[model samples]
Target: MSVAVASASAPARKALWKNLGVQVVIAMILGTLVGLLFPSFAAQLKILGDIFLRLIKTAVAPLVFLCVVVGVVSAGDFKRIGKVGLVAMLYFEIVSSIALGFGLVAGNLLGIGQGMSATTAASGVKPPSAAGAPHSTLEFILNIFPDNFIGAFARGELLQVLVIALIFGAALLHLKESKRLPIERGLNAISDAFFEFIHLIMWVAPIGTFGAVAFAVGSSGTAVLLSLIYLVLSFYAVVIAFIVVVLGGICAMFRINLFSFLAFIKDEIFIVLGTASSESVLPRLLEKLPTYGCSKQSVGLVLPTGYAFNLDGTSIYMSMGILFLAHAYNVPLDFSQQLGILAIMLLTSKGAATVSGGSFVVFAATVAATGVLPLEGLAVLFGVYRFMSIAIATTNVIGNSIATIVTAKICGEFDESVLARTVREEMA
Candidate 1:
């Protein structure tokens, strides 16, 4: 009854034109055409994406806090919540490392950056600075905890906000049911409201995606994309392979059909493609995953934490980006040296989501940490970052969705019947 009721309540049918995914696809086609014909006008449309991002950001902190708090209270066992967290972190570390390895192997095999001459393009294109990134393990740990709770929300620091929510949820566990239940009820209502808020924000998704694609396509000609088109195209191929081979295998092991699971969340995939940011669908996942038979405890505990640590797609980008730079400059990395870089990437990729510019920023920090890769090479790659970002964001959203479902299954928080029901509804 839990998930069946929630999922069954969703409108099972709508006109194709009224569907958000259909609308987004149409907007993307229109936007691409506009970018090709009116580059000048498309450049100005970037504001539409910026505004959408701002509104989405405002909803994230509160939504995450509420979901985690309610999930914790609803589970009725602090020990179980603790177990879910541990399982999620373990899953994140293992899968992310695999993603990094895939990227490194693909770079070596494809030689995507070979014969590239970027010295002229690299100059004057400022590399993203790594100076502000945490220089040590202790510094990184310290940054996760907020000194000012409200300030964390204001600054959109997701890790800090997550820490606050976990502690707040644990504190609620200590309260008696009579007192705690009412608070939980109120939080749940607010969570529903935030879900509604996301639906409203989603209305502007096509507009935002249009502007984003328009800007990306319109401005790409001026960038170094043509010279490095091989890297861009190879990166996409590598990502696709990683998805089908690695993530597909994971789905198979867990008895979840990869195609069906992908179809179930195709809307989220397309939206991420349009906006080129997985954060755009964060709240929507929180609302939808539970209906897909994942418990609230698993969805709430795993998704946000996965955003921080389980960034499988970004993991791939960071390693491949690093290796590609070394190749572009003809900096020969021995087997041992490549392994060392992989080790550094494991740490750097975790920061991808927390950083403002996402994986590109963390990739910069990885380059700085290695000291072998030329930082200027980063600037040349920046020219094509947005092009690669669409695939990265799409992969990430799918990876985290799978992670949540896997976590739910392992923790005994999943319902097979609920999943079957949702699938029927989706197919219908």
Candidate 2:
């Protein structure tokens, strides 16, 4: 611990992009460049990319499960669970609706996917059997609670994991104090350990990002880039507009400023963009929430719930994408039918994965409900959709951050003084 020894260690500790988030970004840029230079090797790079993602995905179910359980059980309140749950569901519905509207407007204005013939490339791939489909609302509800909890984990079902976590957490709260303390402590320890493991694994993110982005760019080449570039740009534009206009208006109504708020979390945004998942920064956000004026209860309640529910970006992408497919096939739809799409989006948007390309399955449901063009039309856009995933993913992160802050302000949990201080730093 001598000053000389500390000084020597400092330089070693300062890695090339010492920040995991920064490393991830550099990896992405380098990966893309490599892909462009060595197109033939792109397929091998994809295997590398898939490995990293699979690692991340494997951890997701456990992470969410433990976090939710620890978050709720640690609150030590039975009634607040119901209260916070209601707030989360309401927030999800309202913001997701706005996102859907934005996508609807953007698709109409841009006229993407318009005037193209339906693709027949996927005609041979049979759809999954109806036995596996959630044919009714009741089936969807019942399927959420798995008969075997371990089976849910094995299957990697996010909604099922969430349900199990919430129920277990609630049951823990009802236990006697003597029994509850031991259980809560053990669960919290496990949650903390898993998060630590994530931090350790994050050291590899920069490398993973490089491989993933490079593989993507190289395999598809500029053809994929050019194909979806417009859609990507338009989607990003819509998200930015939503952040500035809709969320900004919300900030103004509360006498807060959006730019300043975003500035406070610039580092976090960089991390999300590179990693393409906001879940990576959930712990940091929770720590910073108090400084932003949220109460312990509000931060604990709002943030984790928001992850599952208030995915504004996903909602927008789902709506816009469906329309994009509709347009590409020259399928004419009346205004009433378009409105129905929005309604359906409202229901399906919540609980979608925060992972890149996770919305495709849910997108399949919306396509089915529309009863418009053939489902195979989606395959044509599949190649480019991967590139667009980052846009919606970024929007999802930004939307959740804003929602948590705004909700805190509404609940009188925000500290005006802290908000001013944070704003000053952001503006500077």
Candidate 3:
């Protein structure tokens, strides 16, 4: 009987090891090792990595659209949804500013870009102003209204889609019940279809993870790793502090246990770290939030919406990195100039997602907007940027997770009793 029980447990253990995320991490490590040892072989495998990233990008827009619509429409109260959104937006802004401030503080103290000779390596990339860039604020606002909805979606413009969805969802909520029910059902069905699509795409997650990690490790290697130890350590330390200080403060303010909240979402953190894209963990985070006292509608809405508005980690990195570069070049800016950066960064961070290299784009835009340093200063940080990307993306994941739960709890959508009971019982 004991042998039979052991045998049954063995298969389950094996199944656990085969979890998609676990498999992805293992694949990433193996791919990295391969790339480091055999660069030629790893180069051949580059297509595999590229395909995986493209796959994630492809799924992102539709998934976000469906989830956001469903989340908004399913809510029992429009006023309450608005309240939750207001709190979330306020939380995002305050925390993001704090993150930006911390980044500035850490970057100045550490001087990651110090002693680096400026280069024209990024010359051909087209500086925002020189490239005849439109006024960003006006452009950003204008782009929110899609001239072609299908075109916007095809181009994978998340901000535009989010704007459109929010407006449409609000309209749906204001409709008379008899008229609204069919539309709600249709939206729900579309959301279900998207979830099914998510499951289908998830099969490739392990492959993609391996590809991303391999590409990063192979392209960068341990030599770069060894050289940037101080900078890496500095960035990570700030990130950790942000999680503990900022998020923890909020959690405590709400009487939520920080440890319990983090413990419940440990797996989600690992996913974001390994993949370096918080969007990759959206479905899983949504699934897990209900278990953490968030209602299904709250989880569904907040998680997707937060991707655009509540990128706390990205905010921190952008703020810190820009200051680090400025300090490195010995560029002296007056208080007014610094204030200009602070103000522009607030808007640039919102447009951060629209750019190709995440924070790098925002960093570039910041340089342009600030007019404080040579634009090429952006590329000077490229080598270390990859290292910083991981830290930034990880923080974004944790911040959003905490934000979702706290917002849900505040709006009376989440169960305090469940949160308290679970923290005492199942949560570590």
Candidate 4:
């Protein structure tokens, strides 16, 4: 009996080792050890991460375009699309504002940077210039309308692609079924191909995860974390609170189980943790959210738009980060000033999803716009930024997932029974 049990268990153990999540966890551990042992060699492995990100990015533009177009066309009602967009934007604004306020309140209460000396701010890395500052509100609005249509996809500009897809999809809505069906079929075919490509790219995820984690640890070393550990811990705590109290409440209102929801997407969550890029899992969420009972139309529209406009996690980081800089620099900011920062963040955060290094760029731009916090203070965060980014990316993915489901419920497009059954099967 003992021998037979051992024989049966061997294959189960082998299967567990073959699981992607297990592989990623092992890679992260190995990467961390290698980074600690041989910093220089680990840093050289950064190319592996860069390659993985590049491949993921290659799929982003086409996948987004295809999804948005398909979603809009399938909905078959421009009025409904308009309604979904309005509700989504309104929800994003309210939640994000709450997030910003929560972060500020937490920062004030915790006093995270109170004892930190600004002398260490001189990290020799120059602060980003105001010249390359994020777009002003007017410029951002104008920039959404691409001057050249194809140029948008060629450049992989998300906002631009969104605009084009909206217009193209709406135009298709005006066409007769006979005329539009062929185009829809073609787009669906292309979308499938892109997803397949994503599957192939994902096989390299563990390798990429290893390289990325190793490089981050090797390049920065654990010493950086020790110095800013308080700020890091505080930020993480705020994020957790937001996820539980705020997002959890939202889930409760919709009759969804937050823990079950997390379990349903555990694979994607782990991927985001390893890659530290939310866009890395965008396609997967688009494919899976519908299976969780959100209408495909809602998943397609809300998820992508939420990426751009509904960054609850980023809002928390920006508000808290600004306050931390102010405290470290001994700069006095009254209630009105903090309110001003929140207002600016409302605009700047919208662009966070579309740009590279967006959070930092937006941070710099906000600081410059306010002209209160010292630009040098930005350098103080350099060492711990990568670590913070992992949390930010993970939270962003979770937040967007919830936003899609919530929007679906509000729009009367969700089936709770479908969600319950799907969650049970996935969890089982």
Best by lDDT: 1
* Candidate ordering by TM-score (highest first): 1, 4, 3, 2
Instruction: Write the residue-wise lDDT of candidate 1 on 1-428 in tens digits.
Output: 98999898877667889888988898899889988899888988889988998899899989988888888878878789988999999999999989988998899999867788644364355757666666556777887999998998897778998999988988998999899889988898888888899999999899998998898878765446667778889999999999999999999999888898888888989899899999999999998998899998889989998888888878888878877888888999999998998888877777776667778888888888888878778878887888899999999999999999999999999999898898887776
Tens digits of per-residue lDDT, candidate 2, 337-371, equal 88987777766665365222366556666677677
lDDT-better candidate, 3 vs 4: 4
Tell me the spans in candidate 3 whose CA falls farther than 4 Å from its real position: 1-16, 118-135, 174-176, 334-336, 417-428
Order candidates by lDDT, high to low: 1, 4, 3, 2
Model 1, CA-based lDDT = 0.86
lDDT of 4 by residue, 1-428 (tens): 99998887754334777777778888888888988999999999899888988899899888888999999999888888888888988999999899889999999999978878744553555644445445688877886788998888777778888888899999998999999999999999999999899989989989999999899889877667777889999999989999999999999998889998898888888787877888889988888898899998888888988888888888888888898888888999999999998999888888776555767777777777887788777887766777788888888899999988888888888987887788676544
TM-score of each: 0.95, 0.84, 0.86, 0.94
Q: Candidate 4's error at 16, in angstroms?
A: 1.7
Residue range 305-397, candidate 3, lDDT tens digits = 677678878887777767666766778766577667877887778766655556666677677777667666655466556667878888888
How much lDDT does candidate 2 score? 0.70
**1 or 3, which is superior by lDDT?**
1
Worst 10 residues of 1 by lDDT: 118-127
lDDT agreement with native, every candidate: 0.86, 0.70, 0.72, 0.85
**Clashes in predicted model 1:** 0
Give the lDDT of residue 363 in candidate 2: 68
